[model samples]
Target: MTRSPLVLLGKIWLALILVFLYAPILVMAAMSFNASPFYQLPFQFSTDWYAKMAGNQQIITAAIRSVLIACGTTVIATCLGTAASVALFRYEFRGKRILQVLLFPPIAIPWLITGTAMLVFFFAIGIGRGTPAVVIGHVALALPYVIVTVSARLSSFDVTLEEAARSMGANAWTVLSRVTLPWIAPGIVAGALFAFAVSFDQFVVSYFLSEPGDSTLPVLIYTAIRKGFTPEINAISTIIVTVSMAVMFLAARFSKFGGSR
Candidate 1:
């Protein structure tokens, strides 16, 4: 059977949208392999830029710091967010709606505003700028993502399982550990991955919270770009995009996001 014109048009529109979104990233990744530091075209391929990026101690340090911070944010956000999600799912209390509503501002507000606010708050509280400050800001930003993801997973869970467990003399801890957690494990993993991505890719909050000479990879890249553009910067950027895409891909696979399981 022949397809409808509208269906054909929709496919074409989708293809165009995908191309529009990813074409620049493709070009940047391609340029990272080009030998010319200035991005002069002729498509000459070389790994020199990658090698140089590896050799740069500052970049290496920043990359390591970014990973460590992302890991820390993932752990804290996933644990706290998972607990909050469970609470929101299992119990109703006074101001529960208000608590749920409060989770949005960290996500809905612009990062520039949030970052400046955090900087002021931390200063006022005497926390100041550094890795600790960066971690705090990152966890705050990542919590909403984790909570939302885990809460979505919790939505599909069977409440009868908890009731049955309780009737069988299973304690709350036992039911939570053995039943509820097992059912939502995928969501927890996906949430952790999302937390990692948010913290890893975050620039504005990291910039405000991180101390000078000690910044995350995204912040370091911004500093480098300010000095000048180089193939080395392109190389590092390509790496970041690759890692972030890989993480989201895993998150989608685990969570079955936007698709039926």
Candidate 2:
């Protein structure tokens, strides 16, 4: 079949759009390896920063803490969000729409505002500042992601399969566990992975919610950058970018769930 000129033009436009979007990220990745003492354009490449980052105990510890907190947030958000999605999608209830809107306040409000609000709220409730508060804030933001992803998957599902399981002497729990969940497993995993990523990169919430001892990796990076230009920051950025990419790649690869095309 002959390709239309307009379609060719559209493809070219899209390619250009992608280049525009990713060009900055590519530049940052390149600069991370610059050998110059100062962070400037057109520099030599070196691995000193990477080596240094490997030995920096503070950076390493903060990174580990961030990972742990993000994982905890992911588990909590995914469970609660999945449950909410299941109930909202599969059953009828009063004020369901209102609850859905309420769930989105985290994403709807600006991060600075949300962080401040949480900080004050936690203080009022005597929740204290640190990992526990940070986890709560992250969970609030991440749960919306879970709800959106799982609900999208549920919308495409055939509800009667669940009923069929029930007809075959399966209990509600069995039907949910064995039938409905398997179908939406990909979305659940995708949502949880997304939640983890969001929580991992969170700066505002982490900064606000965490006390002195509970600084997250992003917070450490921010403080380091504030001090002065350093190649170590570049190394940290590279490591973070790599980890985020690996996570997204894995999530995309596994989210297909062996389902029909």
Task: Please write out the lDDT profile of model 1 over residues 41-124, one tens digit for every residue.
Answer: 788999999999999999999999999999999999999999999999999899999999999899999999999999999999
For residues 1-261, what per-residue lDDT tens digits would candidate 2 score against the true structure? 579999899999999999998887777778778877576757888888888888989888999999999999999999999999999899888999898888778888999999998999999999979889999999999999889888988999999898899999999889988999999998999889989989998999899888885599999888888888577878788788889888877766656534486
Root-mean-square deviation per candidate: 1.4, 2.9
Quote model 2's TM-score.
Answer: 0.89
- Candidate 1, residue 68: the lDDT equals 97
- Poorest lDDT segment (10 consecutive residues) of candidate 2: 250-259
Instruction: Judge candidate 2 at residue 213 and give its lDDT.
Output: 57
Report clash pairs, candidate 2.
none
TM-scores of the candidates are 0.97, 0.89
Regions of candidate 1 where Cα sits further than 4 Å from its true position: none
Among these predictions, the greatest lDDT belongs to 1
CA lDDT, every prediction? 0.95, 0.88
